[model samples]
Target: MSGRSVKKGKRPQNSGNVLAVETKTTTTAQNNVKFCLNHMQSGFSVEDLSKEARAEFAMALFKRRGMTWTEIQQAPKHGLGSEKMPASSIRAAIPRVFGDVENFLVLRYSGLLPMAGVRVGDVYHIVWLEPQFGDLYDHG
Candidate 1:
């Protein structure tokens, strides 16, 4: 029902125009569902990422969900970083399961370091992403 509403069996045959019109699958075009759940509240904009970083953000989220912290940290590409968000609203936003909101885990991919947030249980609440740097310090 996306483009040119047609009957179930009325899809056009193998044609470039048909495929382009019917099977478009770019991230933004197809699914608006975000990979990072609630990390937007961590103080940043999604527009900050380059296109490559945007792609990697999805990749990091997919991988982080499955891998243990031990498994994820073993990769040379991954590093640990934190930001100081001492605000009460920030702590109140996350579920009580996230133990402490002092710091968060970083998943580095494609020169982008995305926050994996202070996850105590499973399911990470990803926040902002920073491009590669020697270290991350919150400017405030």
Candidate 2:
């Protein structure tokens, strides 16, 4: 009360004890595989896939939900091989945006269903879905 009296209508000053908080930001690595149909053409629709093939595709996606790209590449018995096919050799016309794309990531979801697309990060942007097997790209 004697030292530095507070004036009327003025708030009391805060003590000079300041605390500095150090925050550490962490980023999680993406390990799970993701899929999208961003590049799929209108001509290639899901309706073209047979009921059994559609179910197989869904089941394949479910099974690979926890698998990393590396695991998919390492295991060939599963049939979900992650192979790269030359862009020029692909049967479907690649999007203009991907004109400079050198290769397309091909994934065989089933015995006859081959999904072709580009992988950006962990998401596979599906461009073509060939239910007839070699229609998208030659297996030979």
Candidate 3:
């Protein structure tokens, strides 16, 4: 058989594998971009929240639910300036922003405490607290 005849019968080998690998890489990158965008939109973070700011946040929790001072104190402390708060308390107090009370109640009943507020490693908290409640006295 002639070389031209042999070449005409066989398909190009690299084209199919190259297309498959490119498709996979493109999909992975797209997924990564989507993940980053979602994280940015969530607006949850823990950095730059001062002790006083956290206290103010806790105070807001108290006001929303009319929680007594003692109840406020009893609120779970993830530590000073920490962003973690009991999800039950948050759900009960600020269900509009968090979620339905029923869900939180179920979590509590199951002994699976959910946490809210800014997590220590979160970046959104840093931006939110500074401009809004940087001064404790500003909280109503």
Candidate 4:
């Protein structure tokens, strides 16, 4: 049996100088930009990138860690300047699981190298790391 004594729907009272901690829910925190690589395509893996390219990729992520998705999409040259890539514009076939994703966001990680991902909530799930421009899709 549990030793704690607390009434139903009632929080236990703090006896001494301890303060109760509550979690704050904020929209800004919820909308902050985050990146994930779980969905990255096999051939476009980061492991294949050259040493210089890899360093640039890490630096890019570090530079934008504090920005929100909106800020990343809105700023001028420094921003991600993401473009929409519809399925029709994509050269490679996406897995059936992501069939309903409709479109993907393509951004440059280094010079014109396209990094494609899907946004779910605040997380941008990386799907591809196209090292060469126009290799994955038409940029025209």
Candidate 5:
């Protein structure tokens, strides 16, 4: 027999055919504006949001403010030139904008724990939750 051993039909690890799933949820455009308005009205910050909720909330705030992607990338509040804000800070600020339930679910699904300085893009999107319209969804 030859010195070389023949390989089986099994595919190699980390092959291109192996798909890795990356899921992201976002809020609606109208809801985003409302959330941002709420955040600004209530003075929310990154610290007020949950881990998964931060990215979406941040996107909403930027959208409400009419900020471009480049503007967001170079924004001063993002700590582009200063000390980064903690993830905990962002988490803490989420409720002030999106409220409690949405933020909690977002964080739970995203599998992120409380911490400092988490990247904004790794968490959520701007279309995850439906916008609340007055008492339409409210049972009370």
Candidate 6:
């Protein structure tokens, strides 16, 4: 793997298009996302999810070290699998950065809602998750 490779979503292994995004903000520990307490009341404790699923979340968020915001996947807001809110509203909570809209992106995992974030220079900060989904965050 050489610590850097873009596994395109053509194979069955990547059916969900599990993406590894990055940010300049260094995490003290690997695979630990600062969940938004405001939008969420409570969800599965990272410890509670299956080892495989937890690993998936971690791998999906491994940080696309050098990938640009445009290179990574961005959830769409109109037609087919559209989110409840418009893209602008989803990005509204996040303040301006570097005067570029291409810097921010939203990604949906196997959970109920999608996560909103921004890519500032070399940093991609996951600001929050959409607050519309039910409390429980599970694929099934």
- Model 2 lDDT per residue over 1-140, tens place: 47887668967565654422212442112356777866777555466788987887788778888887778777674386677889988877778978888988877767746777888866788887787867877778
The C-alpha local distance difference test score for the whole of candidate 4 amounts to 0.75
- The Cα local distance difference test for each model comes to 0.47, 0.73, 0.28, 0.75, 0.31, 0.41
Q: What stretches of model 1 exceed 4 Å from their correct place?
A: 1-36, 77-100, 131-140
| Alpha-carbon shift of residue 96 in model 2 (angstroms) | 1.9
Candidate 4 positional error at 126, Å: 0.3
- Model 1: per-residue Cα lDDT over 49-114, one tens digit each: 668777876675565445554454455544432233443433224445554566565455555454
lDDT of 2: 0.73
Summed backbone clashes in each candidate are: 2, 0, 4, 0, 25, 6
lDDT of 4 by residue, 78-133 (tens): 24667778877777768666778889887678877878878886778888887666
lDDT of 2 at 24: 42
- In model 4, the worst 10-residue window by lDDT is 19-28
Give candidate 4 regions above 4 Å deviation: 1-25, 28-30, 77-79
Query: Model 5: per-residue lDDT, tens digit, 24-138?
Result: 4532321211121212313233544556567754544445345333433444433311123322324233433344332221111112221122223322222223222111122
Error of 6 at 44 (Å): 11
The sequence of per-residue lDDT tens digits that candidate 6 reaches over residues 1-140 is: 57888877775443454435444575433333333323321233344445665665455555434333444433243211223223344323344442345433445543545554543444445555444444322323
For residue 38, what is the lDDT in candidate 6? 34
- Candidate 5 lDDT (Cα, whole model)? 0.31
The numbered model that scores best in TM-score is 4
The runs of at least 3 residues in candidate 3 whose Cα sits more than 4 Å from the true structure, single-residue gaps closed, are: 1-46, 67-127, 130-140
lDDT of 6: 0.41
